[model samples]
Target: MALMITDECINCDVCEPECPNGAISQGDETYVIDPALCTECVGHYETSQCVEVCPVDCIVKDPSHDESEDDLRAKFERIAGN
Candidate 1:
């Protein structure tokens, strides 16, 4: 599944640069993760780099954009142009 930055985000600015897909960005209030670009780092790393670096632990799986591992892998391929 794609990940989401909740309102709990502390705006620590740590997660933005960690996203391999460049999905995370500064929103009006908090960081936002674009579901269209988010692959949860499936093809780039073993774990979600943004989540690993998040100081507030506000990033979580987006239930609204739920996807399987295969789906995430597919997204990664599309993003990577593989």
Candidate 2:
């Protein structure tokens, strides 16, 4: 499943670089995760890197972009051009 940054994000700028898929960005208000580019770090790491680095625990699953493990892997492969 894709992840999202909640309003609680403090713009700590910690999670953005940790995203393997380069899905996280600085939005108008806070960091936002691009669902199309997000793969929950399936192909890069065992867990979501952004979540692991986030200090406020504001990153959470994006319900509107729910996807299974296989789907996430596929996304990773596709986005990575592998």
Tens-place lDDT digits, model 1, residues 4-72 = 999999899889888888899999999999999999999999999998998788999999998999999
Model 2 agreement with the true structure over 16-67: per-residue lDDT tens digits: 8898778999999999999999998999999998989888999999999989
Q: Which numbered prediction scores highest in lDDT against the true structure?
A: 1
- C-alpha local distance difference test of each model: 0.93, 0.92
Q: Model 2 misses residue 50 by how many Å?
A: 0.7
CA-RMSD of model 2:
0.6
Q: Against the true structure, candidate 2 has what lDDT?
A: 0.92
Task: Give each model a TM-score.
Answer: 0.97, 0.97
User: Cα RMSD (Å) per model?
Assistant: 0.6, 0.6
Candidate 2: list runs displaced more than 4 Å: none
Pairs in clash, predicted candidate 1 = none
